[model samples]
Target: MLAFREFVRAAYPLLSPGASITLPCKSGGGGMRPWLMLILRGRTRQFVNEGAIMDTIERAGFEVACMDEVASWADVGAVAREVDACDVLVGAHGSGLTNMVFLRAGAVVVQVIPWGKMEPYGEGFSGALAAHMGLRHVMYSIAAEESTMYNRYGEDHPVITDPDVFYRNGSNAKFYWREQNIWLNTTRFAPTLQMVKRMRRE
Candidate 1:
């Protein structure tokens, strides 16, 4: 992790000189609390009720920072710096969760698996990465109704009822990967936040 962080610093000459890339709230100050970095997706697989999730995060006593609001991909250093400061990173299954590499060891990653049978992909993508980086990983798999797919393809539709049969053909995978968005169920998601809190405490 130190080697990778150094590689990032060396690669980005424009990064602020002497910028301390360290996790905040580690020493127990007045502001000591888990700093959560929420990744926001504007296109596909977005969190429709992001505001409610933010509310739940705050209610759980985490200091929230939206990824999009903190740094753009254009500035790798800025992204790394912001991520380095966060003790927790939360996002739906997507490319955004790749930022886990920038996080320090022992930080927690909460990956929200979208409603299809997307658990395998979520684990293969971010979950494994988090584990390899020595970070705690939590997965929140959404129910059928929690997905916007429920509205697009009603309750009885094979896509919602039986994803295995629906995705038998490899060609059908794009529908779930590119065409689905999530309307996260905050009621179901709140417990996941609490789990993260407990993991952080441990």
Candidate 2:
């Protein structure tokens, strides 16, 4: 990771200095800054209450940066520099979390697990990789009520009530992975942010 970051820095000399998106911290004092990057998804698995989530992050005393706004994949060096500047990377389970490699060791990667028994994928995809990279891994599993799936399928539907059976066929996983977006209950998610704050301090 260190070598890759150095290479990126050498390759994109200008991008290294000004890649961060500056947002005011709610907390007045600052020393070793803790940054929280929220990975924004355009099509699916978006936070329906993203404003509330940002408020929660600000209240937790970290400067928040929206991923899509700050970095573009077309420029790998820019994306690496942007991510490398952050102390915490928060994103739903997807290809976006792959950016964790750019993060320094001891930084936090908070993976938001969507509904439909996606724990294994969440753990396998990014959680384990975060640990492998010496970064802390935190997961915020979306509660049934917090997911759009609850409203679409109802309380008793197999997708909600029996996800294992619903996902027995491999292709059926797309309904959860591609078709769903989240309405995160910030009240429930605040604790996870608090945990990240504590981790950053330690």
Highest lDDT against the true fold, candidate: 2
TM-score each candidate. Answer: 0.84, 0.84
Looking at model 2, how many pairs of residues clash? 0
Shift of residue 143 alpha carbon in model 1, Å: 0.5
List, residue by residue over 64-174, the lDDT tens digit for candidate 2.
777763245767766677777888999988888887877767889999999988899999888876776678999999999988989987898877887777567775467
Candidate 2 lands at a TM-score of 0.84
Q: What are the lDDT figures for the candidates, one per model? A: 0.76, 0.77
Clashing pairs in 2: none
Off by over 4 Å in 2: 1-19, 22-33, 69-71
Error of 1 at 58 (Å): 0.3
Q: What TM-score does structure 1 among the candidates reach?
A: 0.84
The all-Cα superposition gives candidate 2 an RMSD in Å to the true structure of 3.4
